[model samples]
Target: MARHNPSAPPESVISIIAPGMQIVGDCQTEGTLRVEGSVEGSIFAGKAVVVGEAGRVIGDITTQDAVISGRVAGNLVIGSRLELQSTSVVEGEVHARRIQVEEGTLLNGSVHIGETDGSTLTHEGQSDSEEQQLPIDAGSWHRPVVAAPKR
Candidate 1:
């Protein structure tokens, strides 16, 4: 005999942007998102956002958490935490409560940690002195997710 539970919550969905695919507009999701291709617009995720080694996002990203291993050319407004792998490259500002950056990552913009006051982090330095910091933890590393093409 078997019993069924009707009140169980559904599993969290993970949206994938397959390789060779590209998105041109803003993307908003209530679950996790994994990007393996290219996105030209902003991404707003209710959960975590994962960017693979080949992923590229040209616009902003607003999420509760993020694990990035690709290239991001716009601002990042993460509410809770953010993790940047060794292969990640970022050219814009970042705002988060907690951040972890691996070695070998390249960042060409400013970073603000702590309270955001409901506003996205803005570049506070002059153009000639753009701040760049990579606080990589020597003992930790993050491996990017590699997606296999569907046959």
Candidate 2:
């Protein structure tokens, strides 16, 4: 069943699963979620999902935004933005309108950025040459440093 937060606005909501907790069933919420524990099933949230350091998720996730600083081992679908912090680790497929991976983060799998419907969003770093060579092993992908064009 879907979980609703009555106090949350129609467009955004917030929920938290602190460290030490473990859930083994599907989670469906119409808001944001901050997880510091472990989940072994699918998660569906309307707004955003933050996975804290030390947290681990072993299932699919669907949300509008995601800020991960832990570990995820499943598919991820983000409608707006997906940010992977330096301490984050992900091993799965990703579909997002926008994606951000901080230096030192680890991701191992396929990634499809921008809207699948062919709409463009504000995106950086990803290139067509790179996209064609996706599903890159985490050991092979290197984050490039953009330098200012020399005059």
Candidate 3:
């Protein structure tokens, strides 16, 4: 029998949860993990996570990158990128550095994207991220002419 050491990391690793399977506990991995069935617990991945169209997750997810085409009922915290396909249905908050959503995807909660590293762009000595009040010049806009109605 070969000995396995948990202290060292593998160069490349990929884990998969197949269809018709049910997992009821938290899962953590240092590499990519794919889910094709149902999970009732949280998931943590150092690399990426891919959820199939038939998959379902009922717990939170933390990962670097994720591609979801399934149903999620908890929060998602993605460090890099996140993609939601047309078949995906999400009902919880989502936080990701970057995100892509398909036209038919259904998201029922708040979504936060982009970096939040305290580096905000500034314009006119004000933070561009904040709302701006533009001064309206009366002569700058012209109203369209309408035809008069005949009595």
Candidate 4:
């Protein structure tokens, strides 16, 4: 698969949430995230986020890019791009630099697209590998994806 450009418009990041899994709580990260199950909280990503066809998010979202192919009920902040797939259904506010909606997608909320001031990017937590080693209900969160600081 081609690597997504973090600097690209928020609509460029490609992510997928496989069917069957469910997540509940706040999520923060960099690069890209795809949800195919159910997410019941907030999402904050430095790069981009994608909600799969079978996915559902019930909270706020902040990211540089975003794509919705499922259902979302919250606010969205996209610094660059936002795309809604044909299977997408969003019920919240959207803030982005660019927005695209495919035929058949449903949106019910406010939207703002442009550049803002003082926006810093960062990611935090542990790795999925580590989280997997622990018990299913251990209450550990995954780490964010961050680029190495310039030398």
Please say which candidate is ahead in TM-score: 2 or 4. 2
Question: Each model's number of backbone clashes?
Answer: 0, 0, 0, 7
TM per candidate: 0.71, 0.72, 0.71, 0.65
Worst 10 residues of 4 by lDDT: 129-138
Model 2 per-residue lDDT tens digits across residues 60-84: 7777789999988777777789999
Candidate 4 segments whose C-alpha is farther than 4 A from its true place: 1-17, 117-151
lDDT of 1 by residue, 46-141 (tens): 777899999988877878789999988777888789999999887767888899989888776678887675554322311222244344332222
Rank order by lDDT, top first? 1, 2, 3, 4
What candidate 2 gets wrong by more than 4 Å, as runs, is 1-7, 118-151
Comparing 2 with 3 on TM-score, the higher-scoring candidate is 2
TM-score of 1: 0.71
Best by lDDT: 1
C-alpha lDDT values of all predictions: 0.73, 0.72, 0.71, 0.65
lDDT of 3 by residue, 46-150 (tens): 788899998888777778789999977777777789999988877666778899999888776677788745434221212234343233232322332122333
